[model samples]
Target chain A: MAGIPKPKLNAGQRKSQRGTEEAPFVKWLLITVALLFSLVFLLLPLVNVFAQAFAKGFTVYWDALKHPDTIAAMKLTLLVTVICMPLNVLFGLAAAWAITKFEFRGKSLLVTLIDLPFSVSPVVAGLMFVVLFGLQGYFGEWLADREIRIIFAVPGIVLATLFVTFPFVARELIPIMQAAGSDQEQSALTLGANGWQTFWYVTLPSVKMGLLYGTILCIARCVGEFGAVSVVSGHITGKTDTVPLHVEKLYNEYQGAAAFAVASILALGALLTLGLKTWLEWREAKLETLAQQAEQAITQ
Target chain B: MSIELKNITKQFGGVSAVNDVSFTVADGQLVALLGPSGCGKTTVLRMISGLEMPTAGEILVRGKRVNDVPVQKRNIGFVFQGYALFKSMSVADNIAFGLLIKKWAKADRDARVAELIELLGLKDLAKRFPHQLSGGQRQRVALARALAPKPDVLLLDEPFAAVDAKIRQELREMLVNLHHELNVTTIFVTHDQEEAMEVSNRIVVFDKGRLAQIGTPREVYEEPASEFVARFIGVMNVLDCEVREGVARCGELEFPTHGVADGQRLRIGFRPYAVQVSNDLMAYRHFAVLRHTYFLGVLLRLELEFPSGLIIRARMSKEEYARLNLTEGRKISLQIRQYRVLAREGELLPPEVSVTHHLGPSPGDGI
Candidate 1:
């Protein structure tokens, strides 16, 4: 009772048949422009940083690493990172857990507030702490009488780094946790697991990947922070100067090879962070494959 | 009563998910809350498990009021629709999690896990995580995990909603067997009528957050309480009729409407198997033209179109249908041997079973 249907046209013919045929030239033009923009703006600058870093060779690089001020700056950066990273990680985990696991009034507003630091400029973030803790600012006389040095000290630098890099872990975690859902936690509770037990056995394991990535991003930003550290640090080399601040000081003093070498350390740190991120991704994929293999083995 | 909901109601935003629902289950009873999606069956199950709080009314587990008890303290195991296994933990560890939380001895926990693994037939899959198991196997693990703590009650939310038909039947059978062995009071939510019929002894039918009917599977199927239950539980053929002098009259068929008033509009429903068809001209006093016939392996489903444009579905055995050598447009006499005056909600609740409606020509005459 049915005749043979007409053969479906191929893709190109189908597009023209539907009267929505887009010009191929425009597509190629967009692709080319995107490629050119990325190459000129991103690729070129990254290449130049490394080229200038090793221009005077390995011995120059070694001397730059050995400089006392450079060593001091590295220590201070590491100190700030070591202190700020854990505090921010805890905050991120708490914030993500609260926002995802519960329903309360003003919850959406609370989430947006956590992301405020990411949108605010780093220099403006530094100025906020400086004003509150400065000699002539709020609580200034109280702190001055107490003989506590905060504005031009290591603590202020740490605070500035903390403010600028606070959202990374939380931002990474919230979406993943939201997608993962509360079924598992609810299951744990029904299984007689308390709130803490459910969080430890169920919630934390699910969000560990996000936590790791967020911690890495937080560390990268904290170590390389310049504007905020520059404002709060008072530019005191070998004391308050972080790695990026140290590089600026070296280049300003006409130490071209040294500055590039110091900048290269920051660049290398970034590369290492990138390496760790990829390794984590590879591990995750491998875990997935292994789980699939296990499933197949059971079926067989 | 093992568990009871006294006028429980749950409101989300401004709308009620569960409205003024009440039920009680005896000890070791396997019951099902059967309904369509968004019918609040899952919400009722959650309230029983203490995972969701009712906006009004009281919930009592055994004799204690558990309205304020959190899910952890309620000691009611819940199997989520997703199976909610710990993706990171092995099947054994997942089963052991509840025991661990309750601070059972390490030795005791292991022994319980081993016992449940053997009971659930997850022997070799003990070390495997959730993703490593098939859907049925994961459900078994979820069941085993829920049973690990030996809770007084277990609530399963659409436990077999995510499996193939063959596996679903097997799981249903397995669940029935498990309940028999353990004899723990259990309640499960499911939209599948066949699923509820196969596993649960008691089926609570819900429609739009209201409890339509609650009875044994056979009772609900054979004697549905309301029009909604009649259509929802099984295949039913309903015809709009008018009551005239205590008789519900359609085109030519009339069914006794015992207590219904005269000149009232009514709907009469009957199952397909209730229709008796014949080839004789004056066999049953009512005749229809056979519009279509489908040869199913177990039954022959026929659509009989009447002169009044009303179509009635009738099913007979394949052997019987083959002997008749039926075709389309054939004159067939039909007699609705049994029928129900469809019950309206809140009107006398459920109509009593009355066998006095012998309002048809003899079935022997139809042959």
Candidate 2:
């Protein structure tokens, strides 16, 4: 058994072998491996976040959060999330609608372009906006004449957040909406419901859960968005600093406890996102069950 | 006319889904658009309901041209094949959906919804979601929703196609009864000929994106305009025949081929019940071998094969098939009790030429 024997089988035999469930030991081994993977990749980092945040005890963590710079970072992060979520969600609705409802040319191209932001580096996304709006970039002269500060200001942070989180909602909705097709909406239309009515009543209700799920993911990305926001924010404390930026500043200044405390807030934000994501998944599963139940109830 | 499609042609890209189809549905008629799958019957239903825009032609609803009108303004209620009841909406909300969109007052919407719910026998399940209801129940909800808005006309695309046979039968009966009670210009599409024949006052038979025939169910069944209609409407036996002395003859049977000259090749068709089976050889000129006898409870179906191996189906009671003891491979005397000259080789025969030379005329004359 030290050197595994290669007693090969034909394709059919191999297929038949695959049909059986994994052995108890093998199943446990795989489960253990998966657990280890998640613990190291996901759980460990999460635990470390909480541990570091609480390293200096309750007062220090509270003080770190209440600090003027930290407060500014928190507000900026929340504002970025608030502003970014709706914009991405709006784009998501429009993109999902266009991709699913109508037959259009360059549809696949548009879809591919939607996923482009997901594949592109967040730094690259930030740079692309910077190159467009920075002093010496494409729209530089026009913006310079008005003395507009989008490069190292809140607007730049918003733009970077927007770019990073753009695909979340649309990505969630596209496949679901495509599978749904336009049958329900078409029914509404034939029943004297106008385009807007059909969307508000039929289309919106069906996609509401997926939209929420996507919006949650989008918010998670927006709130926790670091690389893109960092590259654009210029790290001007109490003015342009997001929580992640503040964490970096604190960490760079060797203020380990303050940094961890700020990191804990962002960690909590991440936890919230994960929690919402898990909840949305559960809700979707429940919806699926209800849908299946309806189908069975009808056919049964 | 409740709905009229004049030269309606729907082209999907370069492919014609419904080609030059023209027909008018008279008000208060239960007209079933009957055809095989992919025969564009659904497209016709959609066009009438304003769900689909015909590439060419005018759609008139209540004698007003609706070609430019959007589906919402057409005020048509369409029930889909899958029963397209809003899965998320409660049965009550689903029904109230159209009414709400139409801006009906809350009181009236409630009353109308209640009326339809009761009309469609969905009283107890009013508050339940679509997923909670049975298939038949969902269909009832869909019907209630469609009719709730008091649409000018109701169009159902394969309404009973989704149900089991027992439920389908029940639905058909209830639908016929509903039509009778409401008399609200309803047009339903179905591939089931029996369902169409049972539920509709008239049937429009489509074949390969064209209207093969448009008439009463019996007319379509008994005097089908073409071979496609005859075969599509019912179980039919078609045979290539030769014309002689103004009579088209298939094997030992002869049918008066009016306006058809001698030596012309023709195709004649008849329904399963159109063939007469007798033990007496003198009763019919044709000699057929009884290839098979199937006891279908109420009626016995027979497959009688001619010498050329051409089989024609005929049905009779158990007592009748039993009396003849028409066992397998037995030579039996058979005659064309009634038949129609379906086509003249390459050309379609006129509807007038649906003469039953032997029986004088169909038992249901206008049928």
Q: Please report the candidate that would top TM-score against the real structure.
A: 2
Q: Per-residue lDDT for A26 in model 2?
A: 94
Give the total clashing residue pairs for model 1. 0
Local accuracy of candidate 2 as per-residue lDDT tens digits, B107-207: 99999988998899998998888778887888889898988888778899999988888998899999999889988899999888888888999999899
Per-residue lDDT of candidate 1, residues A71-126 (tens digit): 99999999999999999999999999999888999999989899899799888988
Two-chain complex of model 2, DockQ on C-alpha atoms against the true structure: 0.53
Question: Pick by lDDT: which candidate is best?
Answer: 1
Candidate 2 segments exceeding 4 Å error: A1-19, A284-300, B243-264, B348-367
Residue lDDT tens for model 2, A96-183: 9999888989999999999998899989888888899988899989998998989899999999999889899999999889988888
Candidate 1, CAPRI quality class derived from DockQ: medium
True contacts kept of each: 0.95, 0.82
Per-candidate TM-score, chain A: 0.87, 0.89
The CAPRI category of model 2 is medium
- Candidate 2 residue pairs that clash: A294-B131, A298-B135, B218-B367
Ten residues in sequence with the least summed lDDT for candidate 1 chain A: A14-23
